[model samples]
Target: MKSFFSNQFINKTSLILLSLFSFSLTSCLDKEGEAPEPTPVAYVTLYHGAPDAPEFDILVDNQRLNSQPFKYNNYSDYLRFSTGSRKFKFTPVNAANSYVDTTLTFKENKLYSVFAVNRLQDMEVLVVSDTVMTPAAGKAGMRIIHLSPDAPAVDVATTGTTGTSITTNLNFKEHTLFKDVATGNQTIQIKRTGTNEVLLTLSDVALTAGKSYSLLLRGFQTPPTGNTNILSGQVVTNY
Candidate 1:
């Protein structure tokens, strides 16, 4: 009778221990089934000049983001970016005098604004894009302008073998325009009809097939003593 009681007790104890172990294993498996959450990212926007003041070029770091054909009263001249700390520089292409280069340390997911002094009309930048194409295929292009505070609208004409004529009119602001062009190395000359000034001359521009290029044109400034014209603008390429 004693042996039989001992055996039954041992069996019950073993079963209880096995059940507890199984419960622990099931709990662990349930915990392992869950997925981890993703980390958040930031967004940034950059604007040139004061919010109420007129500006020509909007850049995110060294990259030329937007140029205005006329003075936009709203948020049209802003560039957006993902969140993080970034360093930026803003240079006025068409200012009367060479302004000090401005730089900013930016935070992700935030908005910033910079300003230009001694404004000149028709400031812009050029960019190139990467869309694969054959040399014999068509081309892509972009246009830009700089508008002065009270200058008249300027007309643009493009003389190149690859792209169409850029006849867009720009007011007192910076404008970045885009278009499709032919593929090859090309020379482009931009002339202002009223002043008959060859505002810009770009030579040996490598325009690839199926790619987009941006051309930035800031305003022109006259010499201090004479009536001669001096060109001041910035150009950049983007893929």
Candidate 2:
């Protein structure tokens, strides 16, 4: 009878230990599968396109931007922010009141660009959802924006020697959808709508595969006497 009791105790103890070991292993595996929370953020860039407007400062949720006031034709690099709704205020330099105020909601991991456009007193912001997707192998993406308030409607095409039209009839304050192009040195010619007269020619523009870009045409086609603003073109790396 003593031998039977001894055997029973041994079996019970072994079973309990086996169960505890199994439970411990399962807990460790559960921990291994779990990961830390991911950080949520959005990317944005700013452009100053308003002619006749002075330099301006930016405030987000009442917090002033760290950079200096943006002057005409100025652009900022991509800035990071937490993903959510935030208020944006644009104030002229040394001014107490804001020139423009609006609320913007941004999604995590997305890219955006904001442009301060038009003349002062009629100034407005244009927000563009930027695509950061890599183009196909050996291809690049290009987009054009016409921001010259006094310029005529125009078409953008490859140089007279090669390629084809990329955008047509792009008017003031208009922007084109992104178009994929072969990656290499490129030339673009801008012409007035329904006419063959080339208004601008961009020579030897470099394009790289898997990259995106934006070309902006700015300023007045014909400025008043003594006006310092001249018609110009600029390119920006989007991603």
Candidate 3:
């Protein structure tokens, strides 16, 4: 019999890429012609958060995962993958040398986001789970992550600190737990910690009922010549 991992893969041909809060169910058959036990599976997404890094190709267990070179600030839809010890490699597009080589276990039935973060010199993979309490009636869930490598500590708020705090003192690579908030449009500001100096402001941001989101603080505070984008906030739908 072909043991699991040797002949096991989601969606048969490969991974099942799901979007937002979604799931895909599939089964496999053993070499004996009988249905095998259900293999543990998980959902994962890849993100290129390294602004100054070259385009990369993602590989898992010696298999190429992305058809195109994953570019800077881009992210892939959640893909269903087999659970257990998995090796990941990120190499420059069409290049033989890998910039990142790491491994992480994916627990069964969990959601994950794998980020290639920081500048090229300090690039690394940062993985995080995507589970949160369900939003109550008329509310939405949200959280913020600080991913700008060269950025100073910051705070995110709708109004001045006090009771309007969404996140505080969030440093590079730091992420906040999901918090439920009232649904509607509101302004968001990324300010220097403990002060009113705003670095970036988002206007009329919408939070829909019964949904969740991840607010990413990415890019460079002082972008290099080749990369012109400055510090900004990106919203990723979690569910």
Candidate ranking (lDDT, best to worst): 3, 2, 1
TM-score of 1: 0.42
Lowest lDDT 10-mer window, candidate 2? 1-10
| lDDT, candidates in the order shown | 0.41, 0.75, 0.78
Best-to-worst order by TM-score is 3, 2, 1
lDDT, candidate 3, equals 0.78
Best candidate (score: lDDT)? 3
Off by over 4 Å in 3: 1-34, 160-163
TM-score of 3: 0.84
Candidate 2 Cα misplacement greater than 4 A, ranges = 1-39, 224-226
Residues 145-211, candidate 3: write the lDDT tens digits. 8889888999887643322578889999888888876667867889999998999998767889999
Which pairs clash (backbone N, Cα, C closer than 3 Å) in model 2? Answer: none
Best TM-score goes to which candidate? 3
Error (Å) of candidate 1 at residue 155 is: 3.0
Candidate 1: worst-modelled 10 consecutive residues by lDDT: 125-134
Question: How many clashes in each structure?
Answer: 39, 0, 0
lDDT per residue (tens digit) for residues 103-144 in model 2: 888888898888888767778888888876676788888888
Q: CA shift at 181, candidate 3, in angstroms?
A: 2.0
